[model samples]
Target: MRRIEKNSLGAALMMALLCSCSGRTTSEPFVQSVSLTRPIALNRETSHLYSGIVKAAHEVSLGFKTAGQIARIHVSEGDYVQQGQLLAELDDADYQLAVDALQIQYDQLKDEVERTKQLFNQKSVSANDFEKASAGLRQLGVQLQANRNKLDYTKLYAPTNGYIQTVNFSPAEMVDAGTALFTLLDVSRLEVEVSIPANEYLRRDQFTGFTCRAAGLKNGVQLRLGSITPKADGNQLYHLTLAFAGQPDRRLTAGMNVEVGITVADTTRTGGFGVPPGAVFLDGEVPCVWVFGADSTIERRPVALREMDNEGRVVVIDGLTGGERIVRAGVSALEEGEKVRVVETPSQTNAGGLL
Candidate 1:
């Protein structure tokens, strides 16, 4: 009987140790301590990022002035060309023969006219015959000039310095006069194209100097504002173009994408606030925040954000006015009307505060 009593005592101590190890907590209500800070006003000026495309300053298509078979093409697509450089040529066999025949006829007419003039001096030929021959010669001369111009039209030359963008005709293909046989892009200057909303477009005049950074560039380059379209596009956006202020980056080619930034100052927006990202939480799609009431209680307040500022803080545009205390953290656990205390340090010790 004494041994059984000792075993029961050992069992009781084991139960007590197990209960202590379980780490049970009291089912009691608690208050959470949170740090409070109010939002401040924003700057009068703001900057925005927009998608832009790099474009050639000028693009042109070149073709022959007269129609014929393309006999030779000296430049291909992507070839660099200089002003007055010969790009392509047409078969001049027919044009040459026409010129030769016309020249011979003109010469013959001239000889006849000369002989007629001599005869007229001697009274051997009538005045009517001499005048008719002279008229024929003069008409043939005009025809000769017209054929010569057509012959010169056989060769195509570049009007300006640029790179060939496209070649539309082959050496053996027949094309009409004025057909676009080659496309050239002027790369001496580069421009960036961006679209902006109408409201921003109205204030484009107030935009300060612009800057742009392309995909492969280590730094951004200053850009000069070119022109803003007076008319709006179908999407209600105005297209604006900015030219490179200095020599553009060599790696930046046409059709390349870039991020363009423009700063605008709006005096009407003199008052706003910046809040930490953690202080705001998404209530579905809308952002909401917990504000510490004057009575030390917490209430959820919906807020509107303008944009992310340079310091990584959200610019609160419309929401609570200035001088409203907000909980810095522990927002997810707090409920509406829950009494809380403002703590100097943001820490995890706010889990069990004054009840």
Candidate 2:
């Protein structure tokens, strides 16, 4: 019986040894694949594009100088007008009649003054009577001149050559003095207005080289830096005025939208890499980036994010050297030293371009 028990124990030990050998020989590390991109050197020329609108260099809202009932409107919205062109007419009957009455009164006074001066020369009139006649003529002359001005005010004329953007009132409508009657735009020159974030206000020196391209145009227009608002707007942005480097096309008018591209360089900064904002994920409140190694494996690398551009991309200031391949997405649920495969897709790159 003791001999049988010994044999069974030996058989059990041999089976256990065989199982261990098979396990050791068949086990191999599994490989996992993921999408990856190379870290772009932050020193490379970077571009920031902003959407802007084309504006007239000079715009004016024309207002009526005097209040009256509109009798006629000679120009329509979008009409081109020259300097001193009559744009509208108010009722001038009252003013014209006043001028005629003033003319009659001035003529009578002049006759009386002439008669009084002759009598004074003949020593047949008193000095006071002659003086009274002379003063009456002078007062009538001034009154007549004032009436003439009132008649002229009945007509609204263009102060400058421009295109009428809009006419606010119709014929027969009563308008008040100093009320806007038309909106005129001087399209002789054009400008682009772009609002940039308050934080990214470019110094006047930085704008020496900037380009703007309007929609439906083939080439870019050189920008002559205009003015930067000293104050922030309601949206916490600053307004930048830029004019075309050369003569702007007449077709490009106010209110048209355009894209302004500004290329900037920062030599003061160094040792940085550019990556998509989404590519970075927080690992326990610390910013981290998953770097892919040449061995088809990924390792979690902590990154020091420096500054973020207006384009939503974060600048990695530390923990990453340029040219290291990194996982662009799906970094939230990844392990250290995880094997990953790099896949190329058309949209995969476009997705990253948003940054």
Candidate 3:
């Protein structure tokens, strides 16, 4: 009976100790491990890329000043031409005949004027008769010049160095005066055209720099502000024209599509902080982030967002200042004012935090 009592008491003490240990384990506070990072200083310069198109600075329409039948076309569409090169010619038979007729009359009147001038000097003719002869000679000379100009107008010449975009008339085709016979695309300079929204148009003066990228141009090209429309179009978008800083590559041509990047100074975004996108969460409708405090506890803080950067980081314009430690990863499972343990970043020599 004594031995049985002693064994039963020992077993009861063991059970009490086991129950105490389990209770202590259950009552311990839970602390979540999380990665933390300090907010980065936001850059005051912001860059945005937009779609643009290459266009020739000057597009000209070639036409004849006088109406006539097309005698021949010296060049075809897509041909490159230099300044003063003859592009086409009209049938000059009728124009030549008119000039010839005027020249004959002009010559005859000139000889008559000289004879009258000598006779007047010799006191054989009246001053009025000499003046009349001289006047007739001058009138005939003016007529001759007018016909010569018409003969010259029958031929069309390139006004500038350009590429022929269109040839509307062919040989033996009759065309009216001032009708566009050819479309010339002046390739001496190029311009890039892009449409921007109203917000950007309002801050057009804040633009700092511009660049463009096109097919076959790996290094890209720099551009300068050429002009911007003062008023918005029907779509409420403003048109911006950009010119090349230097001579552009020869491969770039009119109507080709390109990508334009514009950089602007963000004066309104002063005192902003850049944080990882994963660190930002939503508190109801408002954007919130988990800010780890000095006491090793995280609280949900609302932040006013500006815009995302090129590296996919969220820019917080208000609420959180720089040098604040925020949870960088695994923020969804966290609760308000929850105690947390910061996991140290691994060293370069000891990756994966194994060491």
Candidate 4:
């Protein structure tokens, strides 16, 4: 009777183990339905960043034509001046006196020359006498014109319409000829001067290769390959100018540093589906993903991926089609042929909802 009881107990234990195993198998996720799409190609572009400075395309340094003491400044720094507008005046008292004196002397000489010419024509004066008068009158005329020019130089006018960047001289300050009085700049167009490293400059072809790469870049800024200044030294660097897409109304000063990015190249494919970057797995250098196949079965399929964007989505260039389900959320722990239960939930989309 004891032996029979022991046998019955052993049988019960084995049955219990079998029941537990059956229950576990029933609860396992068979296959999770995943929405899939046909593989499409998406072009991705990248860029190289460099630093530069913003400078006015048009700039003028105002200076006096002659040396003199400043009498007045009509415009201050940051003031807008028009072409031919008086910006300042030098002390003109002495200049005016010189001009006035020369004018009087010129008038008197002119009268004498006219009188001498009349006498010579009538034969009343010697030819030598008329010639002497003519010489003196001509000399005086030249002196008078010089004095007028000197007087005009005393008042400074803007050479071009622009904003005053700096005031180099103040009222009563003595300045020599060619000494800067004001710095003016036209902000209608701005240029960014970027210095490219020598090695990168030699690869100038790369700059032009990326024109399509900038299509979707931010700030509506576009770049074009400008003149590359002569290469100098073993460390040759070229200066690249960045032109803005539109004129900026905001004020820009000289020497403002900026970051310049140039696209190099891009690879694109179209009409395919993409998967979350997290869903991609590496199987011995092969790109694979756990996909919920039809008939409630999970299988890991090899796929080709390209970095679609910076937003953590990989373009499935190949190996996937629309209407197929793939494990997106719980893909990391999933194995090949592993059964999965896909909870039907809202699918996550790119932030803009457009791939």
| Best prediction by lDDT | 3
Residue 292, model 2, lDDT: 78
Per-residue lDDT of model 1, residues 55-101, tens digit only: 99899889999999999999988999999999999999999999999
TM-scores of all predicted structures: 0.60, 0.60, 0.74, 0.61
How many residue pairs collide in each prediction?
2, 6, 0, 12
Candidate 1 stretches with Cα past 4 Å from truth are 1-44, 105-141, 231-234, 269-355
Per-residue lDDT of 186-220 in model 4, one digit per residue for the tens? 66566677887876776666564311112233443
Q: What C-alpha root-mean-square deviation, in Å, does candidate 2 show against the real structure?
A: 8.9
Best by the TM-score measure: 3
Task: Return the lDDT, model 3, position 270.
Answer: 62
User: Each candidate: what lDDT?
Assistant: 0.87, 0.82, 0.92, 0.72
Candidate 3: segments with Cα more than 4 A from true spot: 1-29, 275-325, 328-355
Q: What is residue 33's positional error in candidate 2, in angstroms?
A: 16
Tens digits of per-residue lDDT for model 3, 119-186? 99999999999998888888888889999999999999999999999998889999999999999999
Candidate 4 weakest lDDT stretch, 10 residues = 209-218
Cα RMSD (angstroms) for every candidate in the order listed: 9.6, 8.9, 7.0, 7.7
- Candidate 1 TM-score versus the reference: 0.60
